[model samples]
Target: MSDLREVAITSDSSGQLWNACVWDPFVGTTLMTYKGGVSNSHCLSFIGRDFLISGDAVKPLLHVWALNRQEQIQVRMVCPGKVGALAISPDGSYCVCGIEEKLHVWQVATGRLMAVIPRHFQRVTCIRFTDDTTHFASASEDGSVIIWPLCKVVSMTQDIFRSISDSAEPRYTFSDHSLAVTNIFIGKGGMRARLVTASLDGTSKIYDLASGIMLLSVVFDVGLTCVTMTIAESRVFLGTIEGKIHPLCLHTPPRSLDYHLTETEKQNVFSEHTKSITCLSVSVDSSMLLSGSLDEQVIIWDVPSMQCLRKLQHKGSITNAFFAIVPMNVFSNNLKPSLVLSSFKRRSDTENEESYCINVLNSERILCDKKSENKESLKYLAGQVLQLKSQVKSLVGANLELYRGLIADVWDGHDDDEPDPSFESTQEVGVHKKRKIKHKKKRNLET
Candidate 1:
């Protein structure tokens, strides 16, 4: 199996039409483009292999496009204000839109309004669904994050409104951030599921989903705009407002004991962009990183070396970029790694042009070497060490048993009156005792 991956980008700049494209980073070719959707805002989400959902920033309408059929479907919803963020469930059963301080849930199949959650005090910044689709979380400018049960939220009626004193609160609410919460990311399944939240307060916090306790908290000098973790969740990559990418290790604490640590030691700060970094995405294998910035540049970074593998330019500021896998059948005979970038440049009074474009670039060179073989070799060595330890333990036990048997046999044969020969010999080893015994023997012989 190939460890390399391709990316798909969706972006809109004209505020009227959105474009989706797939890029092969290895060959630097545009594999596919689907540009029929209408979106005036930064809302673009891939629903599945066939459909995409986009929302208009200027209106309360959500557009759904079928990539196969080249058809569009519009779903209208009542919102108190403009939609700020949107997220779709993993199973494609529901779509949640964050409009102002409230959240609206819609059934994707039936186009029916499901429920409304009026919780946050400020504008919602981002929403994310868990990997299992059992729950979802939303971050807001109020500096708080709320995890909601999907089942409970879907069962809620449109008329139901949660009050401030309601006993049925959200599953978890994180309020450690002092500024707006910018992004929320949920880790893949395991014994301890983790949720990482980044904020404008210059801090990113990792929380245990089961216990709601923070396991790690890392503070940066600048506000963070986005975050994504590798598949293993051992390291987290953060995009900051200063157009810098920060990678943090979650397994160990920093060497510095200072509470106000400015920068992480030995951390590679990617500073290619001149503007704030808007979004970041990591590959499934965790070997590649994609970052989109307001400077209209999308960078493909080699994760291990922290080197810029490829730099893709855009005409407009980048809205979003993703590191997605392109199916094997999507291209011809050759299968190479790819990257997708979405950029949008708003037109001025004179220029009448579409503001959105999706660029698919094939990687000219390989980004990373596969580390699976190295991991397997380490595992084999560790197993051998364990086996040797067990063998040595067994040998020592057998030798101890034999020594104990010899001692028991000697005790059984000895009489109490005749002191043990070993003990008497040990007592006669001193030079003064030996001389005194010799003199006594000589005196007895003379007599």
Candidate 2:
């Protein structure tokens, strides 16, 4: 598609030779490619549209890159263990990664460790941050789902001993699944939101976040791998291990404990996948559905027709795919990234400090060597320079105003101070008494 407002992103998830690619889905053309480590399902995240990150399946490292650069950032964050699932807060200030069965939280800007939580008994399968970024959910192979308050998780590290015991305690823990929970999704409205989770137990459960109770449960014959809802919350789409996508209507309220999902074959038009679906996503307007499968194909379906519009066949199993509505110049060259993570530590030690400095210097050297390719690239760079200059001007004006206020206060205080112990207001007691008498005479006249 020629629409610059939205872009299709998918990774060639080979793990070893992985590359993040952007595509023009309608025309079936590759527009851009970002070279770096590959990631699995629930492992890819875009940090505030400035940078992209993914955890390498084979290493305990997270690969990062600026959206303006094709190569991964010189520094990669090494976690305590290999990251299986990763999710960054919507604000991009903090990120929580599921490394094996444990969850690690870190401040993205400073590379500071915030907490270590081992609440899951088995390997984590998915991690998702709520829309408000106030809470996060982690699902695991142990058939448990835990919801953690973002503030409570960080509050532990403020105290030394309390952190040891409190870091692992979550806000809410649900053990409703008899099998491993495959994925979880939280809708809007913060604490009063709704949580939808899919499990391999042939059921998808909905929970009310406010009350911490199961609202409804949908059961099917086949095990579910992933689940998502339409933009309007009209229906829920469940991807099965049997390679079929089931659409469950949500018209009926959650009055019963369980309900069987039913649909006729004539309406089951999204049964094109032949393998277990790994992940699922919907468009911004919910007009299209995107799904990736272990069969190495990413399908784009028209939600209205429930027919496949495009099939993006990959060299490796499709691990992650999603639609992003971004600025028109998001992929433009020579656009400097505003993100800073040079201190994103490997293991939080000083021995690697020198190496990090060297990497930073090397990246700077490469950036300085860049030459504008064409008029369009040059135009974009010039626009960026203008934007920076405007920001600088605004900051300078603000500082000048602050300094003027300080200078005025100093001059006013000096003027109010004693003038060689000869100031009229301080020395003239008779003049003060006359003013007081005038006030008394005015009060007497009023009486």
Candidate 3:
């Protein structure tokens, strides 16, 4: 099994050549390009590893393409409004879009619109999913960031164009920011991870997602435009409208009473871009940092040295820039990934979802096109496809019931024994879960 290399993925708003391009940062080589998916900031993303999804920059259309393809497929899925930000679950089972003041949730594989949640009073600015894909946080212009459990949000409706009831509130509605929230970044470890959100109010707030408590607040002089952390999250980087990147250490909370990040506290600030920063992402190995700016430059920096390595120039302002793994078989003609199960329908109009679903890829058609590959190659590829599909399906269903029950215990009364909300260690969480299971068994026996 080949462990594929990571590449820098980027896009520009006024791209005439290509909307999305894959580049090898080390050698400064453009490996691939995908056209027709013109999107603004935070609108270009991967729907799992096999598909690329982007919202149109100036229109309300959604464009999707497979890994190897350059143009979008024939399946057209339109949104009611222009998308501001979009995120898909890691398993590719669900997709959520921030369209104006509403958050639209959809079942990706089936192309069914599950719920239209109107939680924010103003337009949503950013949306992010947890590393475990169980919960998602949405930030809006109303100066609020709300964390929502994934399963309950999708369970609000099974029909087309349904509104989420008043009773279905978010898991945690945080109104800590005084101005519009510009960016959101959730750390790893699922609910136990910390949530960092930056706002135009010139502050970055960190919250404990599991306990819904504010851990620390770092105030900056200039308003922040983007935010990201390293793999270990020992430090956080905040991008500003002044075209400077500020870094803060997590351990050095001031000896004084108020824990604040001031001008003197910022040990070193990065000043490379001439315009406001649009997006920032750190490499998986925590050795490099990538930042995109409105000055039409995407600069890669060495994290250890804090020096610029190279720059990727664009004709227009850079919109989206991040790191992604490029699979080894992306350019292989014989082992192309098939996406026949997804429909990408605009809306769910009928009771029987399976009746009108569209099949984008056909096995017979592919076999006819690739006549040079041997039968052994085709057989092995087919087996790999089946195994991957089964694995993805299992991942989507696994831990869903467990997380749903945990969330229900948080909101509703504990009809059953449940773990404490503010868990401190892995050992404590496991012990509490086992106790809950044993208590439930006792209740069943008594009944």
lDDT of 3: 0.83
Query: Clashes per prediction?
Result: 13, 0, 0
Which scores greater on lDDT, model 1 or model 3? 3
Task: Encode model 2's per-residue lDDT on 180-287: one tens digit a residue.
Answer: 999888877788888899999999999999999998988888789998887677778888897778877778665578887555632574888888988788877888
The number of clashing residue pairs in model 1 is: 13
Global lDDT of each candidate: 0.69, 0.78, 0.83
Q: TM-scores across all candidates?
A: 0.66, 0.73, 0.75
lDDT by residue for model 1 (1-447), tens: 232456646453442333555566545456565555344333677664445666665666555555443345343334445678888887666777888888877665544455667889998888888878888889999999999888777652432332222222588899999999988889887225899988998988888998988877776777988999998889888888888888877676554422244435425677688888887888877888888888867788888888888876665666667777654433434423232211111111112322323243434434545586677788999999999999999999999999999998898887545668888778767767889899999999999
lDDT, ranked from best to worst: 3, 2, 1
Runs of candidate 3 with Cα error greater than 4 angstroms are: 156-167, 253-258, 335-447
Residue pairs that clash (backbone atoms under 3 angstroms), model 2: none
**TM-score leaderboard ranking:** 3, 2, 1
109: Cα error in model 1, Å: 1.5
**Candidate topping lDDT:** 3
Superior candidate under TM-score, 1 versus 3: 3
